[model samples]
Target: MRTTPTAHPNTELLVYGIREIVDVANKIKGLDPALELTWENIGDPVAKGWSVPQFLKEILTEEIHRADNRSFAYTHSRGNIETRKWAVTYAKQFCPSSTLDYEDILFTNGLGSGIAMLYQMVAPGKRILQPSPTYPTHASFESFCSGNAPIFYKLDPEKGWAPDIADIEAQLQNHPDIVGITVINPNNPTGTIYSQETLEAITRLAEKYNVMIISDEIYFRMVFPGHTHVHMAELAHARVPLIVLRGLSKDIPWPGGRCGWLEFHNTDLDPAFKDYCEAVKKRVLLEVCASTLPQMVIPTVYNHPQFNAWNQQYSTELQTVADSIADTLNQIPELTVNKTLGAFYLMPRFKQGSLNNRQTLPITNPQVKAYIEQAVATPNLADDKRFTYYILANTGIVCVPASDFFSPYPGFRLTTLSRNPEERKKTYERFAEATKAYLGSG
Candidate 1:
């Protein structure tokens, strides 16, 4: 009984690449206070100089001082019933083809919590087929639950990061244990929006395989001028179950809020799916409820007269930044840059064989250089990660390696959330220079 306790094998599968790279940058900063770190690793808009809208802040302020004190109370396990009812009405525009009910909306601390719980609830030996270059949270949790590496269907960068239908179908055919397929529209890392045709094709495949569809639509409202976000619920067949995950964290630009919810679509089509939804609810019951104040302000925030204008303005600004960054990165012949259509990220990939372990960026600080050299020297270190550390030490720009997203390609993901135009211009130039130098060294 007193024998040494060991961590679960599943625990080793969990990795949040964004935060990990930040840790590396922090250590480098410690070694060199003059490093002047530019944080491009994480997707926190507020940290990147985005201000919360005054109207939304005023709504939260009003909710906080309500005489009823409802904001402080624990809501129903599923979430605030009235807020869920309002959500049902609001979500209908995106999922016009699917039937939705108030009872179907289940709120969580954030989508991160819900994503982890969803995978954890899966029966052993079953897997959710995730997209390659996935948001790390989904990949890590799904991998942990399966007790192995996650199964991935490629998102073809050559095709604007659209899901490869043939690859997906092949994976489903090869692995009968895949219980569902997850889609991130206006996808992370690669910010391309899925076309309606691509989504419909995936839906048809899911229908053919009888696998549920999990759509992460956190950035659905953040689409740029030319792109459209097609909700999976709209394309999924009636007999195929769907779970649409939405949250206030991204579009609302409120990472501190930590509020998100899941909408169960087509649950009525299958008793097992209904039971799975119930299991998710039961798990939430153990936690009482998500934050009550954020849930309370959902309707007020959405109904505000200035909300749509604010979101549109933000999207336009994001498109501008994406274009600027992509333009800079594209100039480097060693990289492939895709202009982001939605979301606040740009993933510039290295050309095949462009990055090798021998490549490096010159670091002036002796301490920082040694730290980065040792980090990169770790056995079996991915080339993208090695490049990430070198860039961090050389230019103080922190980006998560695309390989950390389980991408087949070697590259890195950086956020386009910086609000300062001059600062962004300088950062992009420095990043491009560093990338060129790194690749040339090889």
Candidate 2:
């Protein structure tokens, strides 16, 4: 007799929405080789034509050619001590009140790996209150660990995508199992840089509820003009246990480098928290260490005279693209467009009742249209996802549905990372035109 293959229960909880859409688009591309897919589904700056700064590249190259180079060997399990020390010193400029030391930093392959490890170490039966419309990795891993759909608090789009504090409090009150709260400042999918007041309010709740705060500050340095990035460590002030996640991927435009670290704050305040940190470190010991090349060049790249200028220019360009895209999308009366103040994404939501199952864009290829029709026919398909599929088939503009962010709203998230002004304008115009046609159809 033959036996069926078995899989772990946790496997079912893992759903990466961005990749899911990308897989569909990949199949469609195979079906139509001529389709020019304009990728807006993911937040890869380099994929959209941005280049890494020359100074940083030079620093890495020099490190690789050095006589004493240890780039090929593993460092300490917690990452290079000198690099961690540099991180501690540099981080202080933003969070003067933080009590983090070199020992508090633990480097991981990337923030994606770091996120998975953090949630995996959570005690069984415990949960984390994640934001709706969250970065999929956070929600997926949190759910995988707990064996349940993630508990969520809303980020109200009507209020500039700010966290609903009262809703957060209510969820904490209602769900005693929620052990931590995750915040993505200059948030993904909806580029909203949280205000200081907002961060403080969240810190207060964490203090009151006695839950640790997981702050994803990967885009900390990417704030556009007229906004400042507020470090969560400053708000916690050694009163609340905090885990601050940072990375070199976005700001450095080095996604391939895959370097990120976790900063633990106020672990001394709780014995259990201290033990938890130790457990995480031990887990890191199993993996040995993160990439050595990126670790060795941290101090040089950050302190380089040209670094600030490069980052400023990058942020300014993103702001221009953001404003232009927002303007174009807003012209469609059926959509609600919020001009992003930080980061490089624009999430345009359809006005309530504007999207219906019956609406779709015209796809010229009959085979592609048939495939999409079959794709959307799945039971309980989200309105935003259906529209996203239609957009992919019709205009070859691939975007992630906002619903994949575990959002309750109907919309889609697209990046403003493309450096070409003319191409960006043309893409958004075509998208806007498709939006109008889709909404008007039903």
Q: Which stretches of candidate 1 lie over 4 Å from their true place?
A: none
Instruction: Give each model's clash number.
Output: 0, 0
Candidate 1, residue 74: Cα displacement in angstroms equals 1.4
lDDT of every predicted structure (CA atoms): 0.89, 0.90
TM-score of decoy 2? 0.98
Q: Candidate 1 lDDT, tens digit per residue, 21-65?
A: 878888999999998999998889999999889998799888888
Tens digit of lDDT per residue, candidate 2, span 237-302?
Answer: 778899999988888788888999999889998887888888888788878789998989988988
TM-score of each: 0.98, 0.98
Model 2 residue 142 lDDT score: 93
